[model samples]
Target: MKRIALLGMPNTGKSTLFNRMTGGAARVGNWPGITVELLSGKILLGGDMVEIIDLPGIYDLHGFSDDEQVVRHFLHDNVPDLALVILNATQIERQMSLLLQLKRLNLNVVVLLNMADEAKKYGITIDSKKMAEMLDMPVFLLSGKYGAGYPEALQAVARALRYPTPGMAEQLRSQLEEDAHLESEMARVLHHAVQIPVQMPEHLSDKLDRVMLHPWAGLPLFFGIMYLLFQGIFLLGQPLQLWVGDALGWLRGAALEPAVGWLPAIVQGLLLDGLYNGVATVAAFVPLIILFFLFMAMVEDSGYLSRAAFLMDALMAKMGLDGRGFVMLLMGFGCNVPALMGTRVMRSRSLRLLTMLIIPFSLCSARLQVFVFITAALFSPVAAPLVLFSLYLSSFAAAILTALLFKGKYQNNEPFVLELPPYRFPTLRQMLLRGWQEVSHFLRRATQFIVAGVVLVWLLTNLPPAAAPGGPDTFAGMIGSLLHPLFAPVGIDEQLTIALIFGFVAKEIVIGALAVIYGQFGDALGSALAQQLDWVQAYSFMLFTLIYTPCLSAIATLRNEAKSTGFAAFVIVWSLALAWLVSFLFYQTARALGY
Candidate 1:
């Protein structure tokens, strides 16, 4: 099988192109010595099996960042038969630098000027034939999103395999000297060969970007969009949540309850009561997750995220991080695992480490359930949103403050160079496919960890008290009491402390523990907790949950990425210490204010 490597800058639709080529069957693994994943897959072309490797999206090979190193090593060590350079056509000038570097490696190369449709909208044109002559390789204009002109690109790649030409060794030396001359030559060729339309289509995105990228208006617009997103999630999820809850209740009563044997009861409870119900609760948020991703995809596809980074650059700099780092932090709100992995986008080691260190403070989606369930039980509907907003706000504040304190000399200005792809209507098929992918991932996790967590909680909480006289004498009670003092300063009860302990294994398990411990409250726990605990205590719990040590998997990822066990240990201890300190301060202040 012929080996082919796909290389490009981040967010250049490399994944989309891979999915298009390999039918989304790529095996993603961490690149050697880096947490950034390397994607590999096989595709059959003209009865020949080709192994395709998708290298990490990188800007330049000169950087010492994990992603850059990954691409650099891969190219140097296991040279592929063909190097497919996917360039965002709209930003071809900047992307060409990487192409020149790859050319210097004396590898067979094919240039894919992707996002061609978007380039046209920007009054930009690329002459593939002319570009091919200049780069001394085949070049094709294509759009991965629209699936246009891909076949030609693939055929060119296949043909390149048959005729390998080596470039002159001195070409590398000349490339540095004549970069400006080469660009001018390429531009002149494009002018003669490619034609622009008399008038470009007017896009709503342009109008939106005008407002969204405004220095004074952008922040407000961002906040407004966020508020709508939260409201939309809650409104859309209520029905699905109730339906799943009712279905679980019916299944539990109808078949599970009638089982006479102990084995049957245990089996039924484990499968239906524990796994099914637990998964259903999490799955109920599918609509919301899908909607959020849909919006994100639109922004990404339309090339607005780059502009967002540009607008927020100053604010991010104030926090001692760059604009790109801000995007990773924003992603942390959706899920910390991928967000942590996304830190590969950062070019600076200190910046990436600091971002990873603080991401645990972001209010991830799993915690949203806790917020909604608890707030609804304790306070009015309006109060739930307000409380949730405050929790998210607190998390962001904490992240920024931590970054500022940890500011280091590594903070250097790297221009946020981004390609703004033209906006297009999102395809329903794509959205549904992506949504199902995430929902399936969530279901898998629930079955694997959450089911076991529920059973474990049931065993711990329902086990008979030790025959010894005191409450602390019981096995579970003793365990809870032992951990309670550590959490006491934060106003977390023994039960909540136990949940936090389980959360260290997996955050979702905290919900499972709560369900088992507080299920007797029967869906009213949220309102009940609000009434039972003061606002101050509720806020403190939320704060602690946000800043507490990440799950075991996250710690493992941190260890793997940082390449230092001591650093991982530091992350665990530091996060816990910070969580304790912050929660304690909030508790005291809130009490002093008599909340």
Candidate 2:
């Protein structure tokens, strides 16, 4: 299949366009010999199947950022037949320089003035016909968000595919020169093809930014919004979780129990208590995961996520990072594995390593499930969201402390630059797709680890034939007992300690291990947990989970991205020490406070 590359500066609606074009059927894979991931999808154009590769959004073809270098290398090594140079219509005046850079590389390019609708809203207009004539290429006014002129855009691509641009890839490395007059050339093109209102009416984005980005109120408002997000997730997801739990219970009783009833006692125990109870317990949190991702998608697609980063840049700099690192940290909220991968955007090794260290501290959705379960079981409904929000705050606190402590060792000299797109309403389809992707990723990446961890926990709690399950003589009990003294100061009991051990594989398994530990599932598991520990112990356990070692997948990604086993090991060790220290202090202080 012929290859077409989607290239654009960051926040130019490149990803939105990719999703629109590919219908969210894109698959992410690494570029050859490079650790950077590229999203590719196939679509038929004019009876020909062509692949669309969404390259990393970069500001310049020759910029020093990791993404920019990746783009340059990919173009040189595997040049696409056509590069769709997407430019944000509202910012075309400035973004046109990137297009000039690509042209200098001798790549066959089609200029897509994306977000035409938003441009019109800003009292800006682009004459695509004039632009096409001026730039000697096809220029199409398109809105990637709402599919305006989408069919025409595809038709243009189909037409361009017929006339393959030869010698374009070969010229990439040799022809890339410092275009000193590129600014004047872009100005010449824009002067003819674009019009901007001198007295442009104030936009809703501007009106909102005045307050949302205000130095005094921005940080507090960001936190308030995040707090509400958690509250909303709990309020909306609690009943759904209950329903899922009940459904799982009914399935176990109605189908699984009968299906496995004829098996031997040992086999039944493994299948039912080990697998069903464990997997089902974790599966019950799926609703919250979906809701959380959806909320994050809204924040992201609305363009406020970048604003959050901008708002935090000052504070982040103090912690040896920037707004961009904080954005990756926020992405870690969805999953640390990808967030760790995202650190590749930083050019400096120290910056990437520091960001990698801090990202794992994000209370990912996996840990979110554990916190949601614990908070629901221990705290009142009114206090549950508060408790969950506190965990999030603590996660950031842990990340900040880590950055401050390690800033000297891992120094970042690179400057921070980020694009803040205009605020717009996120389409329902986009939000749903984000939720689906996150939930699907959670299930696909987590199922094996969760099942294995829970089964191991089950075996550890049920082995030796003569001992009672989860009793002192069982393997789990023995291990947990051995470590109970060390954990006791932090409010972790033997059973919870066993769960923590399994949790190292994947945090979702923490809930599953708990199910196995208590010899219960669904509502019974929650009730069992409530009986096992008070609110203070439960909170302490959450703090420990929040700061403890990241999952195996995250550790592996850290090793790969940091490219140093020693650094990865240090991360694990430091996180472990921090977890113990924080939990011990919190438990001791809470006890001292007579709570």
Candidate 3:
């Protein structure tokens, strides 16, 4: 199999092109770096199994960083038959530097002019054939996001790989080895191979960025954007969330509820109450997950996400991260899996790890749901929003504190530099596909873990033949009793403890599991919770839930992104200790003040 390495500077649509080529069939593995991984896939192109390797995006391969070194070493050690370099066509002048550098590595090269549509709107036109002639490589003008010109490019690469040849890599290297004029030579090629209108069309992105990238106005605008984002998540996701639960309920009552009566009580408990309920619990939140991702994908596709980072670079630098890491942290509000993956945008290992660690504190929509449920149930309508707002503030505080503590400890040498792409309108197809991809990845990774957790909780709550579900005689009850003295200071009890145990599976499941533990449902469940716990304890429990742990999927991501099980375990321990300390202090201080 001939291997074609996909190389590019970051944010050139390399990953999108890779996904299109691989049909979303990809596997990830760490090479030498603990923070980032190599993405590889096998595709049957032109009746041959071609391995498509998506190498980490680096501006200059000769630059230092885990990603730079990783790609550099991979090229030297395991030579690819061909290199397909994706470049942002809007900024071809600066992007061509990497193409020139690749020729120095003596590898066969093909230039992919991505985002051609955006470039065209800027009155930029490129002569692909002429550019290919001057650069001594194949240049394909296409938009990776829209599936434009892909089939022809793939076929060309397949044919080139099938019929080996001594290409211009050697000839160019000999001419430019020590010439130190790669930039001038690149400018010369663009001079003949491209044309631009004397008076360019007024770019829409520049007008938007003028306000969005403004130091004074940008922060407030960003906050407004986020405020609206939450409003959408709640307005759109909540009703669908309820519909999902109602649908699951209807299915249970109409189908499984009757069938379970015929099975042995134990089997019924395992299936209906345990496995089915557990899976359904997480499944109910699917609407929120999809809506959140849909909105995020829109922001990402419009290229506003990069601008958000560029706007926050200076403020974020104090915490030992760049605008990109902060952008990843902001993404954590939607989902942590993609947020962890987003850390790939940062080239430094330390920056990626620090960003990943802070994401668990992003007050993700899942956790937000739990906070909303508790605050609404415990506080008056006038106060509930304030209470929820405070919890969100707490999440941000914790994230910033975590970043400060870890920033200097694992500092890396690479300075953050990002190119802001022109913003374009997000297509419906792109939004839907991006949303589905994230939701599917979340379901695939989280379902089994959640089901197993549900069963484990069911067993602990219903063992010994006499103990009622979540009763005082079961193993969970006993464990809670033993640990209550320590937690009692923070107003924790067996029921809340059991909910927390399941909450570790997924934060959104906390409310559903609480309903199970209390044997209550619908509006009655809130009243039951309010009766069982006072407002102070209720708020404390919510705090503990918010800070204590990342969901199971996040833990798995931490392991993958951090590249060590030990680091993942450390996150668990650190979060648990911090949650305990924070909640204890909050409760104790409130009590001291007679709240």
Candidate 4:
């Protein structure tokens, strides 16, 4: 199929447009020369099936950042049929430089000035015809978010593809080149075709920024927002989580158990007691994960995410990171794998490595699931959110402490630059889509690990035909017993020790492993856990989970991205050591306090 590449700088609504064009059917795959995954999907335009590849958002094609190199290499290797460059209309002046770079690459180009509505609201208007004439490319105004002028832009894409730009092949045969007068050319086009008010009316975002970006108030406001975020997740998701758990319990008792009743005892144990309970336990948190992504999507699309990054940059700078690294760390709240991969955006290896080391402490959804379960089981409803929020704070504290300790070792001198986009309310569709995307990602990637980890735990606890399941005679029990002395002061029992070990594969499996270890499922598992540990111990386990090693997938990504086994090993060692020390101290102190 013919190909069209979606190219743009960050915050240009490129992703929003891609989703609208492809109807959220895109698949993520790594291109031949690209290390990171890119989203590509097929959409029919004018009776022709064409692939749309969404490239990473980059500031400059010639820039040395990893994303820039990926874009540069992609254009060199894949050579898409047409490059549909999207520019933020309000920021068109600076964004047009990327369009100029693509032109130098001799690719057929069509430009869409996205967020036209927002631009117009700022008293900025562009004459598309004149701009098209000056730039020698088809230029159109579009609101990728609101669907304005999208039809015309689609038709323009179809026309550009139907009739390949003349002399393009001849230009492709020539060496890739650069133009020095990009700024002049862009200025000339803007002078003839765009109009901006001398004193533009102030925007609502500007007024909000006065408060949101204020140095004194911003940090507290950000903390408040995050506090509310956790509370909201617990309040909204608690019922749904309970309902999912109850449903799974009903499934096991009413359907799965009876259907497998005729099977052999080992088979039954493996199927029901191992696989079913393990996977089901992790699956119960899907609702909470969805709610989390939904809230994050709102914060992201509303443009407060960048504001938060800006708010944290000063402190981050002291830690040898910048605003962008903080953004990646926040992304870790969703999943550490992608956040680690996101470190590629930084050109500085030390900075990326530091960010990767810290990201694992960001309280990802997998750990969130475990924390949610523990907090709900151990604390009163009024205190549950507080406990969960405290875990989040501890995660950040751990990350901050890691940064402070390692800042001098992994030095980053790169200056921080970030663009704060205007705050826009995300549509309900966008919110729901983000939630679904995260939920789908979790199911596809984490579920297998959870199921496998739980099954492995079950076998370790049940194997050797003569040994009682999860008893001291079983392999897991023996191993946990061996390590119990090390963990005993921290209030982690032998059974919990095995769960922590399996948790290295994926934290979501912690709950599942607990179920298998206790020979319980769903609510029974929670009751069993409550009986096994007091509030202080439960909180200590959470702190350990919060600060311990990243999952296997995150570790692999860290190794691959850092391209250093030694660095990855260091991350593992430090995270584990810190986790143990923190948990041990907390458990010891809390016990001394007689809580």
Local distance difference test scores for all models: 0.70, 0.88, 0.78, 0.87
Tens-digit per-residue lDDT, 362-420, candidate 1: 78766776666666566677676777777778888888877887777335455555555
In model 3, state the lDDT of residue 171.
25
Better of 2 and 4 by lDDT: 2
What does the lDDT come to for candidate 3?
0.78
What does candidate 4's lDDT look like per residue over 1-595, in tens digits?
Answer: 8999999998899888888888877788888867778888898888989999998899977778998888877887788889999999998778877787677666788999999999999899899999999888899999888788999999999989987643334333223353557677878888999998888899999999999999899999999999999999999999999999999999888999999999999999999889898888888898999999999989888999899899999999999989887888889999998898888878888899889889999999999999999888888999999999888888889989999999999998877878889999998878876677778878887767877888898899997879988889999978988999999989888988898998898888899899888888778888888988999899988898889888898999899899999999999999999999999999999989998
In the predicted model 1, the residue pairs found to clash are 377-526, 377-527, 378-526, 378-527, 378-530
Error of 4 at 581 (Å): 0.2
TM-score for each model: 0.84, 0.96, 0.86, 0.96
The deviation in Å at residue 153 for candidate 1 is 4.0
TM-score winner among the candidates?
4
Clashes of 1: 5
Off by over 4 Å in 4: 164-180
lDDT at 265 for candidate 4? Answer: 96
Order candidates by lDDT, high to low. 2, 4, 3, 1
Please give the lDDT score at residue 378 for candidate 1: 64
Candidate achieving the largest lDDT: 2
